[model samples]
Target: MKAPAISYWSLQLLLGWINFAMTAPMIYLYLGLPLVMRQQGWSGTAIGLFQLAGLPAVLKFVLAAPVDRWARDTAGYRRWSLVLLVGYAASLVALAGLDIGKTGFTTLFALAMLASLFGTWADAPVNALAIRCLPETERMRAGTIRSAASSLGAVFGGGAMLILHDRVGWSWPFFVLGVGLLLALVGLYLIRPVHLDTIATPKRSEVGVRQWVGYFASAQRRRWVVVLMLYFPFIGTAWVYLKPLLLDQGLPSGQVAVVAGLLGGVVGALGSLLGGYVTYRRGLHYALPGFAMLALVALAALSAALASHASLPLLTACTVLLALAMGASAGLVFGMMMYYTREGLTAVDYGLQSSLFVLTRTVVPMLAGLLLDHFGYLGMLSALMAGMLGIGYWSLRFVRGMGEMPPKMGRVA
Candidate 1:
């Protein structure tokens, strides 16, 4: 007898948990590390440069082909995820031992990069599994759920961990992260193995680099890719810098962790769920620009607050608004990306798309760091606001034309 169908809600909840687990390590590096480094009296340039530690994320696409190729018989994606998740968790434990003073920053960077790299390896199969499991009808909601889970992960990795680190030291957060990953591993064991035969598994030879690149050769695909690439840079960079901005603005470290990290994360998580609903009702094309415009407004308000050296009440209000808009935008964009991933080349296609997103998410923040040092907080805010406004306008024109292309444009053989 055939197995019973997994309920849509069950799949969402399971995948959401996995996504939350996957993102926690990233939060430690991206959100948690900057604060730690800054407190250690690291310069903006140094903290900004550490963003390169996420280089593995950008390069994960290059490794996707092998990940997709190997481990097919060993429950394929599940096998890969199992090994990598444990390894990543161990790396976090390793981090707990290191001292990240100016002298040991390189050691810390190397280990952090390794942990992130392992996380990326684990992520490749998870993305493939998500594509294989979700029916086209449920893809949008799946994206939203994944985004919400990611926000929660950020709260754990970025917010709560920061609080823990502030109250105690670095070791507690890292140990807790390892423990969390191991717990997630147990959850992964509970899910039924995905049947690869259900997907349109293209023969290995058919899905080549040339064909993969060719997927975006169409005019519409190119335009849509451009929108995905540009959308996150300005606002994303702002979010990356926002914590340090709060610290610089005279907020105590603990308060900054609560206001900018935890509270913002909670608001962002809720917004992601809401954004998913909006995307379901109005379609992602409508949701993208609408969310972008909201973010633009929030960034403008933030710029005004920065000008006045705003009090905690004003700063907290702006941070909350910005997080809400950003979380929603991220959810909508993630949902939009899911629609473009093809059946056979799910890992490669998703990896390529995600690499582009990570490219901007990683690179622009480095520039923002430089801008912060050279231009002061207000100047940096002004620059980001202008860029966000320009991109928001440009996105509406291009995103409207999305999904209008031939059905086969982004698919595998």
Candidate 2:
């Protein structure tokens, strides 16, 4: 029951806050923008199409080699994180100036995509830093901390911002977000250099995408990669569509933000923190499937509410449960991803896994919009529940096949 050495523990707290900041822009774009645009008479399809702006985040893996390569000689991940934070904050300020009501979709889309690009660049190094800093034993707890940070970010970005926009307008939320990012930038000064030799040291020669992929191509390694790619798509899609579904249920915008955005985010954050503690104590082999099953049960509860045309209050409760499930499951999966990431190439490998994770979260929502058009919210939820069951089944089976490895490999990458 020894705590992580003080140094590694401090690194975890620092990384956790950086993730909170990095998560804000995305939450604002996904949660806030959709609500604002929908209130402005934009169509469901248009709101969903805006998800394309998030494509840069998915493509961030393309930059992973460059980030890792560039950092080798300079200040390491710390430098990359600082540069991207400033750029992302500046982009958020610039975004504030756009009059979305008067602006063309192309222009707004481009700006959002640009902000996301900056955010994505900032995220790669944070992942690398975490992978480099934590020992195998600490990753689950770190994942939970990171997840809690993300949940708080969502509460601010998605919940608080939406309510602010409802009370104020478009520009102030962006201004606040820009200021938050700048404040998070100050935290960079707190991160001291970490030296963990236990992590694999990459030769200067083996630093490219080819080498990164070659490592993943081995028979034993490929299965882990597949697990990363497919694990969270269903729950992710559910999260994206939940806000809109609440709107359709006749919940006031402010109430929806309070229920789904603020209160739900708190529950989700707590769930993530709890998931991390449980995984750390009992091991991921026991925790992963348990979390996945809990997520499925939450989804079932949500689906039933949708089907029954439940009261707004009842729906609100279901939203909280679903958020809790999604947050916990995500924390567990993220911990597993971190555990599996190869040592020296942490950025590239983690980026690749995240790229696939973002791909599903981003793509499925557009399809959900289509389903909503044809079938309504109830139909859409039902379809998502079925997919969640199917995917959860396979993932649980995959968890069983994840045979033992060396201590480092057993952690996953």
Candidate 3:
């Protein structure tokens, strides 16, 4: 009945928010740019190709070994994250100067690609550090706080950027984002000084990729956890299908992007503040089940709204519901995943699961796009619904089963 106390909880939340704030530019810049270019007579396909540039994020697993091995002895992961923040912010400023209007589609896409690559480098250190710092029970609370931080960042970057750029001109988005990242770096520095020995004094055991792959393969009994990871992309892919649906319905692309960003990003961020509370009150067992219900109801409502020619109102409502489902799930599920990982395999387990999450987010969405091409939006939702229901059932069974497993490796990391 005792509450599990976390070390430096407030400081961790601050770091999480700042981390999210610092990293927002990576995706926000591209989210609005497509609509901006569309108005300037740029080909939509040309702008859409920008998605290809972020290929490095999913592949960060390959480079994660280097990140895991190479932090300065003095600062540990914090120093490394700071280094990435500096380089990433610098790339944002460079991106602003790239003559976005005059550059060929290929050239612009390349800059975006490089910027995202820098961001991939940044993301690895953050996640790795989080895995190392907090205990499993604390991860949900941390995730909730972190999700809120990132959600706020997304709102400012995605929602606020759309309106601001249109009225202020293109360069301002880059400028604002650069400043935001700089501030995040400052917040990061305030947490702890870079003292390598203090931060990374643990036993040195190199956990490599093959070992990581084997870990997952060995978790054969935990097959449903991996299955849940594979299913993660459907929701993301389903949402991606939403943008094109809105566009097809004759909504202004910028407005559509702005609305979705506000509802999904800002509202979702707000929703995540309750994530820790929800998990604490309802527990993870019910949290996953609840998200399944939310996703199904919201997606169906959104589908009906789309089919009926309802305007942005219906879209925004559906977006909020989906955002709620995502925020709660994001905060709880990831925390639960961390909870399930035993201490010895902490880094490798995270790396492998993260890779799976990213791979599906990328690949499933791409394949979903092809389906969108043939079946249109409605058919896409039909397919997504079927996949989600099946996966949700399997995931539910797994979560319940794990609760009954004999306690093993229950020590907090």
Candidate 4:
């Protein structure tokens, strides 16, 4: 029998909208902060310095294990989620004032850093909320919907920065964006999901920590761990340094966000929708390499763009392609992340493996930025292409089809 459904209703749609809005300001912050710095007479090094603000996400795994160990009572996931929502909203207000040009950049940067920490903390519980809400069979659908919503959020955030800054104001975007998150907080009340009586919580003893870490050390062949360690970092290659790369090519600030959302988010949504269907129908085999190739092609186009001094039209085409590739790849990677890790132990049993996945995502992308800064865009894109080639090689050794693993433990989620 198929697992239970999340039941499409007002709550889920509201959740989608609110999450998008709550996240919108930061997304703008990431894009706009650098532009603000550049215009403020700051150097690229200073702008790149802001990325260190994301360090909490990389290290949240240490905290994630503790979160996994305790599942709240009464409200279950909702209880913790509400706390995170409040913290996140308040941070949005502080973020509006982060004039990196001012004397207290370190202090403002700390606030920005806190926002990422809270956001990732919120992500852990919300992901659990998804596990509670959707069945395995329909998760691809759920992921597709979630990603599309996120893409829409990106579009809205990006578009606001692009079009509205001229007329409304720079900080004005924060007001609307902050309200978006606040609305999401209200959305939880509307969800009213049946309490997950069978909800998975880590054992509060040594057994829990052992089990959590034990999965990585499993004797299955060590290949799965290798896969996770080796290739996942490469997944972020194309857009890793995209903003800096674009600005270096001379795209205007507002246009950078507008095109990123229009092409990256809107076009990306279409790509994700199509990818979800393919993943649901065919399995990971077709899904992984197909998306990987799309990314590889996008990289080739980017190399050509940079080599040609970033012809505007060529760069625009590159942006859309990269966005679509990333959209589909999001499904491929996360879908695989879910399938490979928890099904054997049971979905709710995801407490251990799930946290590791989250940890890696946070760590890997942070590393991507550093690597991008060192290598320059073209050099990093080339390295990313190499990363894709590695995944392609690894996939050949391990995958049998969707939901099937060749008996070697040689897969990465």
The best candidate in terms of lDDT: 1
lDDT of 4 by residue, 1-413 (tens): 32234454443465557557655666666765566567678768767788778665555445445444465332556667788878887887786665544646677678778877777677656655655554455445556656667777777765666456547655666666777777777777766445343344433433254555666664432555545444445555456567668888898966776666466778877777788887767666666666777777877888888988967787888888888787777655554444444422332233444455556655666666676678766677777788777776775554543244422111312
Would you list the clashing residue pairs of candidate 2? 339-413, 340-412, 340-413, 341-413
Count of backbone collisions within predicted model 2: 4
lDDT of 1 by residue, 1-413 (tens): 22344655776788788888879879888877897888899889888778778788887777677766664332577778788888899899899887665446688778888898888878878767766766665676777788888889988887778778889987888888888788878876766554334455555544568856876877776877877787767877778788888998989988987887789888988988998887667765667778888888988999899888889999999999988888887886787677665545667777788898888876787788888899887788888878877778877877556544323211210
Summarize candidate 2's per-residue lDDT along 1-413 as a digit string, tens digits.
33348877777887887888889878899767987888788889888789778777778678777777766422477678788889999888888998878987788888898899989888888777777757776777788888889989988887778778888988999998888788778877775544333344565555666866676676656766655655676777788788778888788877877787778889989989888877666665667677777778888888888778899878878887888788888887787777666656677777887887777776777788899899987777777778777666766666677666424332343
lDDT of 2 at 145: 85
| Root-mean-square deviation of every model | 4.1, 3.5, 4.0, 4.9
Report lDDT (CA) for all predictions: 0.77, 0.76, 0.66, 0.62
Evaluation by TM-score, superior candidate among 1 and 4: 1
Q: After superposition, how far is residue 111 of candidate 1 from its true place, in Å?
A: 3.1
Candidate 1 stretches with Cα past 4 Å from truth are 1-6, 33-51, 71-75, 96-109, 163-171, 193-200, 206-208, 308-310, 403-413
Q: What is the lDDT of residue 21 in candidate 3?
A: 67
Instruction: Give residue 231's lDDT in candidate 3 (0 to 100).
Output: 46
For residue 289, model 2's alpha carbon misses the true position, in angstroms, by 1.2
lDDT (Cα, 0-100) at 232 in candidate 3: 53
Model 2, residue 22: C-alpha shift (Å): 1.5
**Of the candidates numbered 2 and 3, which has the greater lDDT value?**
2
